[model samples]
Target chain A: MKRAVFKNNWVAALMVAPQLLIIFVFFYWPTSQAMYWAFTLEQPWGGGNTWVGFDNFAAILFDDLYWYSVQVSVVYAIGATVLSVGMALILAVFVDRQLRGFKAYKIGMIWPYAIAAPAVGLAFRFIFNPGAGIMLYLNDAFPGAWDPNGNGTHAMIMVIVAGAWKQIAYNFIFFLAGLQSIPRSLLEAGAMDGARVLRRMRDIQLPLLAPTFFFVLVINITDSFTDSFGIVDTMTGGGPARATNLMVYKIFNDGFQGLDYSGAAAQSIILMFLVVALTVVQFRYIERKVHYT
Target chain B: MIERTPILNIVTHLILLSGLILMIFPMYLVLVAASLDLKDVSAIPPKMFPGDQLWVNMGVAWEKAKFGEKFLNTFIVAFGVVVGKIVLACITAFGIVFFDHRLRMPIFWAVFITLMLPLEVRIVPTYAVAANALQPFQVFMDVTGLTWAINAVTGIEVALEWNLLNSYTGLIMPLVATATGTFLYRQFFLTIPDELVEAAKMDGAGPVRFLREILVPLSVTNIAALATIMFVYSWNQYLWPLLVITDQSYGMVAVELGRLVPKITSTGGEVAKWNIAMAGTLIVMVPPILVVIFMQRWFVRGLINTDK
Candidate 1:
């Protein structure tokens, strides 16, 4: 019995060795290096780094540009999240009613999410091109119509609209799946209680779909705040003189473009804290509202 | 049943129809613009109808972008990444689940923590590693005088002259290990009952045989879903490729499309060819859109199950 147990343990260890090696090299080591580099002011050309404890963090916190970026990111995240999730809920409810050719619409709706962000940004840029863009044409037809690149506000709005357009489909697909999983008998029970359709949706459906809503909210926020540099990089390049700059785009610019590794790492560490705090708040406060079933 | 009313139904349909139209109009514009002539493309309000310059514009874009070679490069890189990820993720997940040991828990935690560490955080270090540390083994290279062994093993000649900087290896190698794929497969393998594995072991099926015959066959749905997701992701990846690949002729479609936009000058007075850029955008978005439309059922199913 003892020999068998020892042999099984040895086999298990042998099998697990490869996976552990990959995780250590790819995930753990790189992350640790990033954290370490945040404190050292290393030069780009072989110059040794000086230890500037808390200076990098303090610079980011005190800078006006950093504050502006954080504000813009929050606004974009909230706007995109609300717009996408609201539209998704409405679309899912409509599709759930068994419309003809629902599958085609379902497929079409989810198509945008699969397209690469840079490609989507490029497509939208063309669609809104100043001379030939349909939106430009429509704006020209009306008096005092604003150009997308005319000002910071217009540019910010355009980015948010584009982000929301790409994200709604993702939210819709998930909500549709969540709606499908809810047992019909409960809905039938609500109906039998003389609950109006609106009441049924408000009282039963909304509460039941809370978990999916929470999940979508988290994902949308993460994508908008953290992963949108690709789109911004391709579309505006944080441009028109930094009008559309967000937190992630700022980090990319500071680190990779400006070659300020310590500054970028400091910015990244700040962003990391923001993400963790938000996630913790969500779990502590909003998790209570989720109906897991 | 009597509670049902047409008023609510009409309202719902109207909303859905408008949203769907909004979603599709950009793609439609791309198709229309791609087919238009340069003269027609620059016209006021831009012509919505297809023009006679479809082949001409395609030729111009192809020549300007050196698109054929770029497309081939992207295909090789994307396919290689997809295959590598699938094999690596499957083997890793299998090793984690089937080979239960004390080390498994810590390894699992390490993978889980990666979810919080965004790629942006690790880009600088990862770039350094790719550039300086990792190099192809030269023991099997073709040049004999260079102190590198030149030999063909299994009818395959290993080549080292190909610098990864502007090639397919640069595009694919950095993306081999995906945290999302690993997590997906791990969650999926958990659903398989232990009894099946026990039975396979009783029949003298080793780890390799059990994975080949039993685990892989039963996990087709999960694998298909993951493959579709990874393929689309690999094809559409932009940021990393943009940073690493400097040569225009070897970059992906997204990079090519981005170069279409000219840098804005102080005057902002140039008459840009909006039609051509729109056309290019259309071409770039087609493959992933088609993939999603055809394989949406599996994609949606995958997203729903991912949290589990």
Candidate 2:
């Protein structure tokens, strides 16, 4: 209610000053710079630019490599999202059936979110290293058949696996929450008709959990899109001839390494729009259905 | 509880345990790799068991890799971000919800835009802005002829310099404005009964006094939960410090751990040993994992709630 008003504009300004100043300088200023550079021609090192309208966007839109990066990002996001969400859904469903050691599963499962993407990347690097770690035995049997370091396809797999590993813990929590929210009477109704567990889950539980599934789908895709930087940076640095070069990583590569400020800014704009578009779609789709609980 | 077959229960355990193994395997790899010596690590097939050089490798990571300084920097940055975010978010939410302001919604949505574009997107320009923070002061000097003005006024010739490039403020200041935290606190505040606000008003307390005395106390649990998540998030930030700080002294553990993986020495020789890298990885993981484990309940609730 607006009735609890502290009627002083100065006090309000004082309170909102810190966040406003920070967001203005860091977020809005940088964003505007990126947008301006996206529309101009700029020298990364020389730091002077000419106003060139739509050339950067035109080049990026027409470039095969840029489109390739987008394709790789889509595949990576889809692979990561599907793998994590599917495994998490399975784990959550099975765990929902048991009562013995839920605490252990809960503790063990919620941990990946704590571990950073780089940490996950490094840990998986150890495991997936061909010479040492867990992959050593496999290489011993296959000689040269399994080498993620030299193989583009396998490199993509490595990144996807690590990305998915990072996401599953998050997806698992949501799935578990969603599973809990399914009414017990619905399952009982299915059981009275002699439906098996699978049938009951397929008919009653899955339909009821559709909202959660949709919610998880949006979250997983968005997270996978933006958060894949760390995993890519650590695991391969978008290596093997740019096979695993995701869109975000390409931005960092172009700007920092290649010093293509304008190109990178345009790419950043595209990626920003991609995220905003996903967020809009999520809210618009879920607004009508998210309140089922 | 519907009918539970013993077979199905066993299968459920089987599936869950397998999932657990998948989740825990990489962690096991970290532990195993860290424990092995360079010889064992570089041998024909990798050693799976813990070796005797665990302490040695950890010492190398600690002393040689300069993780001690990195730990201090990371600790400072993370705690700074956490405290800054919570305090600003609380007050901002308090202002938005309890106080009357024309720009409240506008300010709220302004913070919310940060959630759309992550740091990875605008990293270059953000770095540009951070690196040249003294530009405005320079322009001020030129515009007003402030140097001559100051000399005329006080006879002190001075120049302004803001070397925030490699400092803690550089690392944390750019990161502290978050919409999610403010949104959560606002949501929590919306649930606060208006009678409480009215009561505080009847008692002739100002907004600051009401916030300090009432809203802060009511928000302890939410604040703590959000703090756990933010700490992990800030601790795990990969690109912010990388772009801002160039000095080796200010290197972060996450960024430095990436450096341990050296290139192949020669065409025929073995690569750099990973024992130290794995040890560094373990050290990097300890703080956040411990945070998650200790704050399990709050962490879980906070992540699921804030995200959804």
Q: List all candidate RMSDs to the true structure.
A: 6.2, 3.2
Worst 10 residues of 1 chain B by lDDT: B133-142
Error of 1 at A144 (Å): 5.5
Q: What would the TM-score be for candidate 1 when compared with the true structure?
A: 0.88
Off by over 4 Å in 1: A1-19, A43-45, A138-144, A278-291, B1-3, B134-164, B265-271
lDDT per residue, candidate 1, B52-89, as tens digits?
A: 77667777776666678767877787788778767777
The numbered model that scores best in lDDT is 2
Specify the highest-TM-score model's number: 2
Model 2, residue B238: displacement in angstroms? 1.2
CA lDDT, candidate 2, residue B162:
69
Across A1-293, the per-residue lDDT of candidate 1 in tens digits comes to 01111125565565556555555555555555567678888866777788888888888889998888888888889887888888888888777766666876777678888777776776676676565646656667884465667667767777777788888888898888878888888778988998877787789888888877877788778778777876777666676767788888887788877988888877777777767665665555346644353
Candidate 1 clashes: the total is 0
Task: State the displacement of the C-alpha of residue B295, model 2, in Å, after optimal TM-score superposition.
Answer: 0.5
